[model samples]
Target: MQYLVLASRCLIGVVFLASVSTKVAGPAAFAAFVRSVRRMLLVPSGLVKPVAGVVVAAEAAIVVLLAVPTRATAVAGFAVATGLLLAFAGAITVTVRRGTRTTCRCFGASTVPLGPAHVLRNLLLVAVAVAGGVAAPTGGSLRLGESLVAAVAGLVLGGLVTVMDDIRALFHPTPASRRH
Candidate 1:
């Protein structure tokens, strides 16, 4: 149970850490993400920057909250993660239903457009957070060996999310364009 809980915490933490790195690489990259958000209609044009700020701040918080060794902190992190994933899933679902194709900017920069896949992906993450939160102990107690194992497992899973777009693209390539 501890392993499961700790692994979940690490997975979400690493995910946020990787995501934050890409986002804060520089203002240009962050601005691109903001633009993508506007294009997706996740927010009105005027509110794009503010929304982006909140998203980035939340990601930063997730990284910290999930890392601290405490049951309360872990639960808070999972709660935050769950909300973020649901919000993302909702945004993608709306875009897909509207027959709109827009880049996902999910990781600072990307060409993957909004699709059912994106919605499913977010749902999966939400499940992980929920399951972890449930299994988490009231007191975050782990031996050195257990902590190491959980961290390793979490990092591996987290890294997989980082390049998931590319992996999906490999299996389902975007159709090529041709000149008329």
Candidate 2:
């Protein structure tokens, strides 16, 4: 159970760190993310940049909180992660239902349009956050070998999640194929 909780925390932290890093990589990257935010949500153009900033700040906070070696902070981190995932899922659902096909700038620039896959991914992350929160131990220690295994698993999972859109593209038909 402790290993599971640790892995979950690491996974969430890695995901958020990747997300924030991609968005803030450069001015153009950040701008693209803000544009995506504007397209996905119903916010006015003037508010889009600020909204993007808030999102990045929240993600950074999650990484920091999860890094703290305490059960309470871990729970808080999971709670924030879950809330953010739910919010993202809700926004993606609404955008998809509206027939919007803007590319999701979620991990930096990507051609994958906001769709059910994005929402599904977020919901799965939400489940992980919930499970981590519930299973967080008050205090514990792991053998060096066990810790390494859990850490590696978490990192691998997080990397997979960050590249989900690219993986989906391998199976999803191209625009030209759709016309056939």
Cα TM-score per model:
0.90, 0.92
Output the number of the TM-score-best candidate: 2
- Model 1 pairs whose backbones collide: none
Alpha carbon lDDT of each predicted model: 0.82, 0.86
Candidate 1, residues 12-79: lDDT per residue as tens digits? 88878888878889988898878777878757788989988998999999889998878888888999
What is candidate 2's TM-score against the reference?
A: 0.92
Candidate 2, residues 1-180, lDDT tens digits: the string is: 788888998889899999999988999889889888888766888898998999999999999999998899999999999999999999889999999878877777677778888999999999999999998855677788998899889888998999887776678767521211
Query: What are the per-model C-alpha RMSD values against the true structure?
Result: 3.3, 3.0
Per-model clash counts, in order, read 0, 0
Cα lDDT over the full model 1: 0.82
| Residue 100 shift from truth in candidate 1, angstroms | 1.6
Runs with alpha carbons beyond 4 Å of true place in candidate 1: 139-141, 175-180
Query: Over 4 Å off in model 2, which ranges?
Result: 173-180
* Candidate 1: residue 149 lDDT (0-100): 90
